[model samples]
Target: MEHDQELNNNLRKVKEKFMLDLVDKLNRINRDGLEYGSSALNVCYMTSIVDKQILQCEEFLKDISRGYFIEDYEEDPTGYTNGSIEIQCLNATKTYTLKFTESYCGDMAQCYPSFKLSERHGVGEYEWNYFEDDYEEYEANFNKKYSAIYKDIEQKKKERRIQDIKIQMEMLSQELTALES
Candidate 1:
């Protein structure tokens, strides 16, 4: 019984660590832009790498949960629950903001494992699906073309060439942001 308790504690620690790492990676990607402002292939590779790490963590957690290595605990406001676990989990997942639900002081203790696990797996698939064979060839072509343009500009050393490129890129970025807004 003690061993089981220790294993459950370890699994909880691992899950918490993995969640923290995932958030950090997400923030880094958001700050760096979706495309890396460098190369499509480079961006694809980086995303794929992050995706694999998250996937491995997710799978490990799922296995642990399957083995009943973690226990679910929640605070009952009135000391008696009125809703099914499934309903509570679904509401928690859908109604809570990521900042609130996934925060260090979050209410994830009440969250349903099934919803959280499914969302994690879906995100991992979305991240890695960008690197499949068909998409890889497309990205390679994009990288080759854009990189060649950049290389040509460097070889010529035209006056204010890099600055002009930067300005254009900035304008395009602004336009994209405006469109999204």
Candidate 2:
């Protein structure tokens, strides 16, 4: 019984650590992109990666809730939730595939998740093209393509700041009005 309690405590600590790491990874992906070759691929990979991690964590938590002792348990390292990540873009005119190796799950325990581009079609003819490992060029093009998104995000942030200031002003005005009364 005491051993079980100790195990549960240890599992809780591990889960907390994993959750923190997951959040950090997500923030990094959101800020810097997925570190994948292209923006499209980055978006696809990031979503899939986050989904997989969430599912895996949920499953582990479920097992723990059920009092199942999970030994050597770690986050799924399969590069994808499943075997491969398939993305269709350009009005379904282009398809891309990123496949994970059999060793990928094991590798995940040791390093960050990664995938290899297994297949691609209709490159250069669509909004999302296969990067062919040209990461530097891909990053440049991605930034250029998504500059508007960054601008819009900044605009929204500024608007929120303005709204907050207005709220503060109103509150102060009410306080002054009360004092004058």
Candidate 3:
């Protein structure tokens, strides 16, 4: 009985560790993609790199969900397609949706992802904005925000490049080890 318990505990720990690593990798991939730039080539490269990680994360979630029972499921709300995905939490009785727009026109024109949370009673939305007009007053503010985001993207690219190098080194090390053995 004790041995069985130990084995189960070890397995649980391994699962947790794997999940954490996968989550970290997903985050890195996302950051790297964003940092790559908005050009078509960069976008395609980023998509390719991140797509596999996204699938792995989905598979990992599915594997873990097998241990538990899901109580409720719902079809997605109407008119929420085209780069939008809705997530409904059965346990919490809450629904969340993420929508990305290449160009969103509201008070201003901007390009970014929009996140929304909804419950039975109320809804909340978050979005980023950019200057739509050439007004001098808004120019300074807009420039500042744009510069900040640009700097952040550059920094992320640097971090992603370093991480890629590390991953390559680790793969090489494993191959060398196998060859030696």
What are the per-residue Cα lDDT tens digits for candidate 1 across 77-173? 5623210111112212321111111111135353211112232333222222332454467557535644533343333344345666999999999
CA lDDT for candidate 2: 0.40
lDDT of 3 by residue, 12-74 (tens): 654554334333333444455456642111222212212222322332233433342222212
Model 1, runs deviating above 4 Å: 34-116, 119-181
Q: Between candidates 1 and 3, which one is better according to TM-score?
A: 1
Error of 3 at 115 (Å): 15
TM-score to native of every candidate shown: 0.25, 0.25, 0.25
Local distance difference test, each candidate:
0.37, 0.40, 0.41
In the order shown, what is each candidate's alpha-carbon RMSD?
18.4, 21.0, 18.6
The TM-score-based order of candidates, best leading, equals 1, 2, 3
Model 3 lDDT on a 0 to 1 scale: 0.41
- What ranking of all candidate models by lDDT puts the best one first? 3, 2, 1
Error of model 2, residue 117, in angstroms: 20
Clashes of each: 0, 0, 0
Q: What are the runs in model 3 whose C-alpha is more than 4 Å off?
A: 1-145
